[model samples]
Target: MPPDALALYATVILLLPMACFFLSSPTFLLVGLEIPEVTQLLRGLFNGYFIVMCVAGVASAVAYVISGRPVFAVGALAVAAVAVMARRWFLQHMDVELQARAAGEAAAVPRLRALHLKGMLLNGILLATVIANVPLVV
Candidate 1:
């Protein structure tokens, strides 16, 4: 795929889990795996959330196609939904981590911070790309 399309795919993939991660669980799939157990489990648990994201994307794409213009809004909403949910979840988790830090569990704080940054960066990029594509429209 071209870099643009690849980025779009990445955005879609990120959204679903992000939403679910916030609403329910932190489990997710990494690129590589020993047994793929964690990945499979997370995917299984959040499958409905993923479906909702994809459906939202497709619906937005349909509207864009009908209008004969690119609307990054579709992608943007998807990303935002995910980010909102993920952030909510992250904040909740962060509270726990904060307490742990107070208790001198420094190790978990760094790891959680890393994960938070990673999620924020990824979602931010996805949202930006969606907006950038608006002029090009679909």
Candidate 2:
């Protein structure tokens, strides 16, 4: 691909996750409000967000590689891996805890909250990493 095209691709890839991060941040904060219906809706939204992250990460890595920037490709792949981990492990466990809490297991509430906090922290880190890579890749 031409240099200009590659730059555009890189910019789009970077922007995808940045957009997702900004949009999802508010939902993360609202997780603590303890509205079951809203929480359920947010859970579905987060699932979509994580999937988008993974796809965008892979796309960014591939674009970087095609653009002859292997280091940026690796960084992008790392961000994708983090998203996969959050989706497969953190989110999965959070769902389990939520179910348990719903079943009247009071102890699960704190655990669920902790997991939510961890998810938010991970998301912040991922957003920062992606933002930092934008200039390097683009």
Candidate 3:
């Protein structure tokens, strides 16, 4: 397969989950996080997102390298690195916040909501970046 095609497919893999979450996340807002299931579901969704992004990013990096686009390869690697760090940070903080909410702290729900919003915002930025740079790569 052509390197450009490889990159395109790899990016599509990355974008698929991102677009899912981007659309689904706001729907989560339609419901409240006060429900235990909703919080856990959101948490699980984000965990999955991070994992998928790591795989997709590496795939994209390999594609970029094969295409002789080393700089884009580096960007892809950075995306993977960011996902790795963000995963750890998110899981840790999520656990603490979950515990706090479990313990009846008033602020925990809002914090979770903030995390949700931040994730959405970050995902949007990444999606925009990928599309924005497609002209250069393809």
Please give, for residues 13-117, the per-residue lDDT of candidate 1 as tens digits: 444554454545433323322223543443344344444555556555544444443445455455546645764565556556555655677475465546545
Q: Residue by residue across 1-138, what tens digits does model 3's lDDT show?
A: 887887777667667777887888788788888788999999998898889889888988887788778998898888888888988888888888899999999999999999888888888998898878877777
**Pairing residues by index, what is the TM-score of model 2?**
0.80
lDDT of 2 by residue, 17-132 (tens): 65765676566565562557766766676677788888888887888788877787787788788778778886688688778878888787677667666766777777776667
Worst 10-residue lDDT window for candidate 2 reads: 25-34
| Best model per lDDT | 3
By lDDT rank, best first, the candidates go: 3, 2, 1
Clashing residue pairs in candidate 2 are none
Following a full C-alpha superposition, what root-mean-square deviation does model 3 have from the true structure? Answer: 1.3
Which of 1 and 3 is ahead in lDDT? 3
Q: What is the lDDT of residue 59 in candidate 2?
A: 88
Tell me the whole-model lDDT of each prediction, alpha carbons only.
Answer: 0.49, 0.72, 0.84
Residue 15 local lDDT, model 2: 67
- Considering lDDT, which of the candidate structures 2 and 3 is the better prediction for this target? 3
Off by over 4 Å in 1: 1-71, 131-135
